[model samples]
Target: MTKPNLLPRSSDMASETSAEFSWPPLESNPEVFTEYLYQLGLPSDWFVGEVFGLDDDSLGFVPRPAVAVIVTFESLKKETDAVAAAKVDFFMKQSPKLDYACGVIACIHSVLNSLDSITLVENSILEKYYRATKTQSPADRATTLENMTEFQEVHTSYASLGQSSVPTAEDDVKHHFVTFVQNALGQLIELDGLKKGPVVVNAASSDILKDTAAVIQARIEAGVYSDSLAVLTLAKVADDIDAAVQALIDSSNGVLEVTSVENKDGAKVSRIKCTATGHEMPPRADIVTAHVNSKRFKKATEWYSYDFAQFEPYIVSHRRKPKCLFCNVTGIVLNKIPSEVEKHMQGRKFVRMKEHVKFFDEAEIDKDD
Candidate 1:
């Protein structure tokens, strides 16, 4: 039998007219916005995180090489700010029909403007939406976004996860969001869908984030956003994730490396050579039973979990013993030694098991839900 179709059908969604096209306000929290970008084609490598404050100590917490910043404020005025827009770098107006959409609109601006550093997922919802609106006039682009059904579905799903009580479409909201992006010309500009065009914040912005903080701080001092003000930044999770993982393995104090691994019956012992020193550190049976326990190990399994942290989601090591949750649940003989780990990790069945583990792993994490 054919698998049931997983995607939401347009008919399954709440339809809207210009007068009734209101979405519940999205939360400005990091996890919510990070998932927003991921669903809209932002890769797992980049994530949205909160920028705690404008002070040097607080700004120091910001992840380095951040691409875009989105700040939220409660506007006391009923209308958009009366600032004159100029030199449109990248600006798409939010259709008047798309109410309570400023948060999502600001995120779109963040990703589109960061395309220089982003390689979007193939034909992801945001990728297609970008191609469709790239050449359109600002008004037409807004109309296209207003009619996009997939986006509407994704928005509604995540919006419900907000910690605060959900508001109805007709609820009046004064909170608004805007993004700060660096244009191709190296100028830091603000993209607010409510504005006529890009607002130039800094012409020669040596650092867009610090400059954005300055702008946001000024607004705060002037009584904008008052209690509801917040800042969220879309930043590269790490400059080199793989290399970072490698460094962790390398700095294991010479515990990970082995000149040779020999299996003695059911147990495998390695002649661990300290790379830092030219001497060997034997895998001794001190007093400890095992570095990990079945309960300490998540209820999952993997072939290469012994390799390094990058493969952690797949497998994990307790002492030198590589444990797999697959074995635990299935009552199969766990790989008892280091030497046995290599062949299993390299096996086609184990390699193909990544997605299976991923699905199972996500289920485990969201079990609380």
Candidate 2:
């Protein structure tokens, strides 16, 4: 328009400046192109710089097109921070052929790799933190989660029994079954992690028969027990209880084995064996019954009551040191008592006397007072 100016326009001038600083064409030599990008602030880790020279064809014709080499470098970093820098290097290799779509796919792949690295690092951090603060064993934590989930399911299933106008024997059996299964599963999970062995659910506890059947059914669904796994029932081995054994066999597809044992009431107990073998075995129960009971009832009775007919001597020997029982105990120690030995056992501490005495006289009391 008014005799077009020979001088370049502003856009053309800007383009010339950009062209001067532009990355070298990859067709000339990919290494030169990569180095140019690196000089332009591209990260060193973005591309693999190894040179694989041209290959030979038939009759030793060395004419294989130079192939760009890519090597992976992994670093733990936030996904958002790494994507943009990764994308620039990826597109540089593809720009000569105008393979924009390929370049985009490569960038996306890099982003996914970065995200996966972050996720793995996060899980590892959580695992380390959990070990640092948690007092429970790793097996305990794993079993706790397993038990809690199972307990919640059972609790939800039994809630309807609460509102029933007439509670029947069937309901009682079901409730007992639920409790038995919950306990058994908890024990099994713990044992599974510790023993690294299969939990052989000894069906000797008649209270657990119905529950065992339900457990077997559930395990079948979870793939813990299958047709190959052994399921032994005492009923099957005994002539009088074959029907009970058959009932369980009919309920599950697992292999059945039976044995007999005497029940608490003098009746023969039917034992069903659900042996979990191999790496697939579930955990065993935490069999801390006697220890747990001792801890639970320790503080309920005074020092005299603790020196029972069976354990009196041991108690005396343990308390002779004028030890601070509470501090030594597995439980929290509140105060130090010079005479009685206080120690934590299974989250509870107990104070037991060094020697039994009928009474504290006025002189002893007066000295302390």
What is the C-alpha local distance difference test score of each model? 0.65, 0.27
Q: For model 2, state the Cα shift of residue 177 in Å.
A: 67
Q: What is the TM-score of each candidate against the true structure?
A: 0.59, 0.13
lDDT of 2 at 256: 28
* TM-score computed on alpha carbons, candidate 2: 0.13
Clash count (model 2, backbone only): 26
Q: In model 2, how large is the Cα lDDT of residue 347?
A: 24
Model 2: ten consecutive residues of lowest lDDT: 278-287
